[model samples]
Target: MLNRHIKSHSQYKKHMCTFCGKGFNDTFDLKRHTRTHTGVRPYKCEICSKAFTQRCSLEAHLRKIHGAALHFAYKQRRDKLYICEECGYATHSQEVLHLHLQDNHPSSTFLRKASKKMEMTLQKKQGEDQTENSTADEGSR
Candidate 1:
């Protein structure tokens, strides 16, 4: 085989944790993921004052509040989605999964009306389809 010099991340440093021996591409990621084992909360939400151990969780919260569609779009691209064991709801990211666990399985309150929106849209679309079919049948007759 000919020599193939495929370049990789030049500055990539495998930040390894001595406890688990797992490696990451970035030191910041290793620091952040280490909090899972340490049970540390570094980010706090200003709106609800809810604190999270991970920045990813905080980002997901903000995205859910301000960019739900964007977040959903990002989720559909995941290889395997995470489902809530408590409610069987699927999430693409760890943050949303954690949020679902907190909201459904723990002592947490919902700030958004997810069920109301889904119900209203479902009913409205059903009514529109029924009316359209009825009108089309009448016109054909």
Candidate 2:
């Protein structure tokens, strides 16, 4: 990951954007950068229905985009801003925050709990939708 991040900003830029001629050290960074000009956000969050060009950005959205009030409203608090209990580092992102936690506080179960909550929320919603569909089918018969 460090190599990829470093490669992205290194002086030996290899990949060049076709639209704006901007250069990048890595192809993945170049592809993500191209999305800016294209306005393409293929990655979508199931929880809040937000889209992002990169998976990392979408994960960030899942960690930080929604406020606490809105987060609770949508039951999407998993996407809310995360503040490190160990250090002062804060971000509205997931993978980065997870990395921070793993690096700083190895034994913390916060990430696991957050992930489980999000998964259970999604499962509950799916079950509700299935029940509604089944009821509608029975009514139609």
Cα miss at 54, model 2 (Å)?
A: 1.5
The TM-score values for the models, in the order shown, are 0.33, 0.41
Give a tens-digit lDDT track for model 2, residues 1-141. Answer: 788987866787798888899889886677678778867666668888777766567667777765323334443345455544344455777557777777777776556754565568779999999999999999999
The 10-residue segment of model 1 with minimum total lDDT is 1-10
Candidate 1, superposed: residue stretches over 4 Å from native: 1-13, 63-141
lDDT of each: 0.58, 0.68
Predicted candidate 1 versus true structure: per-residue lDDT over 1-141, tens digit per residue: 121122124344457765587776665466556666655564667777776765468769877875633344544553544434333455566456666766666642221333444458679999999999999999999
Q: List the residue pairs that clash in candidate 1.
A: none
Give all candidate RMSDs, comma-separated. 17.6, 19.1
Clashes per model (N, Cα, C within 3 A): 0, 3
